[model samples]
Target: MKLRFLPLVAVLLAGHATAQEAVFQTKSLTPEAALKAAQAALESCRKQGYQIAVAVTDRTGLLQVLLRDRFAGAHTVTVATDKAWTAASFKTSTLEFGKDTQAGKSMSGIRQVPRVVAAGGGLPIEAGGTLVGAIGISGGPGGEADEACAKAGIKAIADALEL
Candidate 1:
């Protein structure tokens, strides 16, 4: 009986080892691409007569690039960065996250998390059907305007990010 149990344990261990060996590949946003996205977002807002700040972050919520228009307020920079971080960390747009959190009593606690900006202007960046980063805009007159700038940033790089 002891010998039989020993063999079973060894077989299980071998299977576990094989499962642990399985690996997956993931992609992340590059600094160059992040810069382009930020630039486009700022440009888009400028075209609309809005001075704004834009930030881009990798999948891990690490900022890769930031841009501030000449007349943007100082606070806009931090808001943009936090918005990008929040979107990347949560895997969704800040606008959607904010609405959902507000509507659900249990999820409202998410707003207390550090660096979580529950607002518009944050959007996850996707490449090859996977989330690779996020872009955020701030300093616009309203959330809608800020979100439009963020969308323009993603649109600028959509072709390059295609699978």
Candidate 2:
């Protein structure tokens, strides 16, 4: 009787193992690509006469690159990194997130989350219809300028990320 049950259990376990995937694949930006994006953002801000700091993060919100202009403020580092992390983690542009979470809005409480920056400088990096990473820029005149620089950064790496 016990032998009969053991075979059943074995079959059940084997079926379960074949039914679920043991591992899944995910895409992320390479370190070199992240550096290129950061450099492009910094250059874009510089062209606009705005000293800034740029940060890039992988899909998992892990920092991949960070670049700061000589005249950028010290605080820009933390702000840039937070912006990148927020964009990647939230899977949305920080500017949109900010508007959605503004005071008196239903998502206002999200503003209180640690490392969650809802500024315009952060943008998600998507390729092949998948989010690959994020970029953030800080130390510009305002969120708009920072966002513009971040856009330039994405544009610079657009072709390579087409895959």
Candidate 3:
């Protein structure tokens, strides 16, 4: 009887150890949520006296929402989307690449990735250490300013999501 019970306990322990659970499960933003993110960022940028373009990308780096404030240069929209894609795909801030390459770290491989901009202004939207996606902003006075706005938008959304 003791030997039989030992096998049962061993099996239970193994099952518990191998129990798999979702980590950073993917989150899909409702259209309203996406719009709010864009709008809030736009308002924030305007308050700072900057006309900016903002883009939100999904976990896979695909465009989910994009908006460009009136008077923002067309180029900004393109850059915003590209930066968001880069961050979502790389699972890190685009600023990381900028700093790394500026330090002469031989970014040949990184440069080869067509979607990567290696510029500041894009940040990953993470939940529990897992990347949910990314947001990017452009058309501000500087890339750092754009990055700040993007981060603010991400924070707003993260708060709403209760993450």
Q: What is the TM-score of each candidate against the true structure?
A: 0.85, 0.88, 0.78
Better of 2 and 3 by TM-score: 2
lDDT of 1 by residue, 1-163 (tens): 7887998999999999998789667799888889888889999999999999999999988999999988999999999999999999999999988888884667999899899999999999999879999998999998789999999999988888998
The regions of model 2 sitting more than 4 angstroms off are 1-20
Question: Higher lDDT: candidate 1 or 2?
Answer: 2
With candidate 2 superimposed using the best TM-score fit, by how many Å does residue 17's alpha carbon deviate from the native? 7.6
Computed on alpha carbons, the lDDT of every model, listed in order, comes to 0.91, 0.93, 0.80
lDDT, candidate 1, at 88: 93
User: In candidate 3, which residue pairs get closer than 3 Å at backbone N, Cα or C atoms, i.e. clash?
Assistant: none
Give the best candidate by lDDT.
Answer: 2
Q: What ranges in model 3 sit over 4 Å off? A: 1-25
Q: lDDT at 116 for candidate 2?
A: 93
Which is the winner by TM-score between candidate 1 and candidate 2?
Answer: 2
Q: Tens digits of per-residue lDDT for model 3 on 45-94?
A: 89899998999887787888899988999899889999989888877787
Descending-lDDT candidate ranking = 2, 1, 3
